[model samples]
Target: MGTMAALVFALLAVNILLGSYTVTIPDFFAMLGGKTIPGASFIVMENKLPQALLGMLAGASFGVAGAVFQTMLRNPLASPDIIGISYGASATAVAAVVLFGVRGAGVSVAAIIGALLVALVITALARRRGGTGLILIGIGAAAFMQAVVTFLMSRADVSNAQELMVWLTGSLNSANWERVGLLTIALVVLAPFVAVGSRELRGLSLGGDTAAGLGFNVPRARLLLTILGVLLAALPTAAAGPIAFVAFLSGPIAKRLNGGAASLPLSGLVGAAIVLAAHFVAVNAIPGTSLPVGVVTGALGAPFLLWLLIYTNRANQGG
Candidate 1:
């Protein structure tokens, strides 16, 4: 609990300090309180503050969702990003923006539908096999979705294409209080359900038969968790357009940090830290450009994925 609180505080502080423009902590706080500090007000109020808030929420949501999926499947590779949920969300959102002329809440709804569809497909394909088979099928679905996104990009007009490209890469540059509010509502409403189900989740880790023997409704519990996980992934992807690998890495990283607590709250905090840290680095590290936060995370996450695969292989061979 102490570590999670400290990490959250540090992430909030870092996000406030490091942006395209600079502001002292005091002035930033003052502006946030509506104290109109001349030139600093717009930078702090209109831009950086909202972006930071959204980034933290989005990151935390992705992290929690990833942890839930991994725990439910008893597979480290089970994540929305890995299982094609993010791609589904992104593709649907892009299609809405380009073809249906949708935005705001409508886009989010579309993205959710897309994510559910892809999840259903993956589930169907993997029904006959185990967790490993599910993961392989998910990977294939993700590849196909990515191909569709690329094709859409190729056909878009230049101006729209530029915007779509930025969104496709995943960015928080356009984040505002509205996005923050939406995510907050989601977290408040859904997070508790996940929290309440922690015991059932732990039972699941022991395998379906064991869980059933222990008087848990394994299928019903799994369904509920899947819904929760999908909402967590889909909401953030709708808000931020698939901000790569925060979901994929947060669970394992948190487990490593906390010596495997298996607590969703702890994992969620670590996820917030990873996302906030990455966004801070992206905005500050590149002065003029302010590269997409997703790019930074993806670059880091891709390598981590490779390491995980190698580690898993070695563990399998050793056993």
Candidate 2:
């Protein structure tokens, strides 16, 4: 916990201080104190600070959402990104941008609606059966949504398609103070349920019947956690298009770090670190061109995911 906490803070500091337009320590403090320092102030106050803040918020939200979903379903592949929620948001946002010429908060709103609608569909369909059914359906839905996004992109004008593609890649280039506050408010509002749901998640982790034996209403607990998980993923997708695999990867990494014990707070911290570090690399590591943070994370996460699949397969075979 301590290590992850320090890592999150360090990454935040690095993200805010080491952008293209640097913020000296003294100048950062000065800017914080309501004193403008010419070029430094706008870069710090208007750009880097908000970018880092949104990244931290969105990362934490994705981490918690992933952790809860994985624990509930006992499946490594059961992330919002994998199970269609992220795809729903991505598809709707793309359509809004390309077809309807929507921008700004309108895109966010469309993404949120799409995510929530997908969540409703998943829950309604899965309620009649087991979790495996939900997972299969979600994967199918995700593929369908991805195709929708692709078709929309193909139909767009060349310039608009290029611009939409950047947003689709999940860049923080548009991060602003308003988005920071919006994400912050969302986290604050949704936090209590997550805190309560974390406890419920522990019960759910022990299996549905076992959780029921322990006096938790199994279905209710599952629904609450599912709703919370959806919101966590959706709001962030709205703020910054669905970040690649942070949601899928953070929980398992946190559990491994904690010796197979899941800690929501630790997972959230780890997530913040992942996003901030990815953003740093995205901006700095590429010479002559900056890539989206999602591009970097996707490159890193795909290999880890492949290894995890192989490991899980071998373990299941051994069992």
Candidate 3:
């Protein structure tokens, strides 16, 4: 945990201190302290810093969402990105843009509402069919939502399609103080529920009957966590399009780091680190070609997904 937190801070510092337009440590401090350095100042304050901060906040949210989903379902593959939740947001946001011509925060609002609506449906299915069923159902829902997004994109006007494509790819290029402020409000609202969830998650990890035997309301706990996870994911997807795989990868990575246990807070830290590092690489990876952060995470996640599938299969066979 300590190591991961340090890495998050270090990546943040690098993003601020070393970028296209470099600023010395002192000059950066001076800018904060009521002085400006012309070209460097605008880039740092307006562009780079906002992206970096958004990366951390949005990443942490993704991490928590992933951790909650994975823990609640007891499946490594169960994440908002892999399930229908994120697609619900993306699909709604795209429809809002392409169909209704909504812009800015209106799109985000649509995304959040869409996510909750999808989650509510998925939860109903889970209640009837059980955990493994939940995963299968979620994957199917994801594919369905993806199809909706694709159809909308295909029919969208060129101008709207262009914007939609950029958002779908998930870039931090649009990061700004306004988004940062909204996400901070979201975090503040959700943090207490997350803290309260720690115990519920621990109980649920022991299995449903056991948790129930211990006086935990298993169904209620699951629903609460699911709602919490959805909001965590939806807000980030709204702020920055679905940055692929951070939500999918953060939990397993944190679990590994935690010696096969899960920690929501730790997952959040790992998530922040992943986004920060990925943003750096996205900007610097190909020099003149700055790819979207999602592209990088998507590339990284494909192999990890393959490995996890194989590993999980082997373990089940060995068992």
lDDT of 3 by residue, 171-254 (tens): 898899999999999899999999999889988988899999999999899879988999999999989899999999999999
Local distance difference test, each candidate: 0.85, 0.87, 0.90
Candidate 2 TM-score to native: 0.94
Query: For candidate 2, lDDT tens digit of each residue in 1-319?
Result: 9989998999999999986667789888988999988788887888788889999998998888888888899987888998999999888888888889997778878888888888788868887767778888898889999999999999999999887788778778779988888889879999899889989999999999999999999989988988888888888888887889998989999999999987788888877888989999998886766788899879978998798789988998995
lDDT of 1 by residue, 1-319 (tens): 6978697888887777755567887887677677997777877787787888888898888988898889889888999999888898888888887787787899889889988888888988999888888889999999999998888888777987898887778789889888889989988999679786677788998899999999999988988888888888999888877988999998888777777756677778877887888888888786677888999999999999999899999999995
Error of 2 at 236 (Å): 0.7
Cα lDDT over the full model 1: 0.85
**Candidates ranked by lDDT:** 3, 2, 1
The TM-score obtained by model 3 is 0.97
Model 1 per-residue lDDT at 217: 98
Span of 10 residues, lowest total lDDT, candidate 1: 13-22
Residue 292, candidate 3: how far off, in angstroms?
A: 0.4
Please give the range of 10 consecutive residues that has the lowest summed lDDT in model 2: 123-132
Off by over 4 Å in 1: 18-20
For lDDT, the strongest prediction is 3
Q: Please report the candidate that would top TM-score against the real structure.
A: 3
Clash totals in order: 0, 0, 0
